[model samples]
Target: MSATDDVDRSSWLSGYSDTVEALPIELQRNFTLIRQLDDSAQELMDDVASKSLCLMNQKTVLSPKERQQRLANIGSLLNEVLKRGEEKFALAKSTYDTVDRHCTKLDMDLQKYEDEQLIGPTMGRPSTGTSTAGSDKRPEKEEHKRKKRKQTRGRKKGIAPEVDEGQQQGEYLSAEDAKQHAQSAISLSNLPIDPNEPLYCYCQQVSFGEMVACDNDECEIEWFHLECVGLRTPPKGKWYCKNCAELLKIKQKK
Candidate 1:
């Protein structure tokens, strides 16, 4: 909600490779073609049925030569229907093959980008279904490793942590602190009772859903719920806690 990566979601999507955007549109066109083929085939079958009924009628007297000509017309119509169906089937197969190739490349590209993000100075921040590349969802573990800061027993006071110098957005965050935040970034829903504490965010609810971590090293309350700050979707890049965002704005205006 409040905290967002430097690059906005729209901007990131716009800059993606051509295939990423085009493949969806292309797939839709293919589906439409398939539907059209179905309708056309049904209409042709109705035409054949109507002609067959006419030939079967005994009330009308027909010369041998005329009867033979009617039979020929029916045979040609049936052949036409078969030809049309075969052509449509071939086109559909080709369309699916193209889609398969595009997806395979997209998978490789996303995997490489995700691997790169895990290294270097920004290492150890757990992503919560948010990234500019829009990679595949990270696999959910049946059980997440439980690691929490020591805290006193009770319903959390629902108090905001003290704002230190490091609480500023995109400011100093020690590597060790980043690692700690990443390790503790489990789904709030799965956070066990007693040892774990939830002292930050305006809602001040215990781990109940997906969470994102502020990069700030000294942030007393480092983790925040994605929903608490009004974010329907995760931020495109690095997300800071609400306090850090406000602090950053004040500093900017100054």
Candidate 2:
């Protein structure tokens, strides 16, 4: 190899060694011990083979009893080596399993901490204004105005306002009435499913039940099962998924 190539290789090796050394002490020690054990095991096997060969080449003629004793000794030595190797493998596997469990627990705890921070009690606190009470009530008023504005816009566009089916269901209606109600409601054509997409819902893999399509024109998630969104029946009129609803809210604010 060229001198420059050798220098580059040396530098890479040095960096890799530093990275390994920066690992947790316990992990580094475990790796070091495993490497040493592997090397020792290899040397031992080599030594056993060499010694056995040397013994076989010896000119000393052995009786049947002596030959059997020699074979037994070699077998015992090999068995000991195998036992030691097995023990080392078991130890390494156990250490890895313990580390994996600890990592999983740490990840879960970190996620919980993040969630708590995001949804803290003070997150939506109103800023100071002329009066504390007025400021506190301002958010509720703004929310009401936003809903009214959305309804007004829907009416202007000749679209039926959204309604929660779960809340609006009245006393028993006949099947014929129900069918008529469904027909009168805005009809959303089924969006074509992608050829590569799975036919079943990712959340629950069963027959595709009553489905709803997002009203948003630009949403990539064309359709999802009503059950997947915790709805027994499709909502009346225009429907938007939670994500699309949030987006529309932001757009309105802007």
Top of the candidates by TM-score: 1
lDDT for each of the candidates?
A: 0.58, 0.59
Question: In lDDT terms, which candidate is top?
Answer: 2
Evaluate residue 1 in candidate 2 and report its C-alpha lDDT on the 0 to 100 scale: 38
Clashing pairs in 2: none
True-structure lDDT of candidate 1: 0.58
lDDT of 2 by residue, 1-254 (tens): 35985797589668756654554676767778777777777877887798699678969998989888877877777887797698678667766765665556556655665555444434557644534555366468667875575455444433334564532321344566556534433231232222333343224232244555556767656455554554555556667777888998899999
Clashes of each: 2, 0
Worst 10 residues of 1 by lDDT: 146-155
How many clashing residue pairs, candidate 2? Answer: 0
Model 1 agreement with the true structure over 113-165: per-residue lDDT tens digits: 55655333234547644542334323321112112231211114232333434
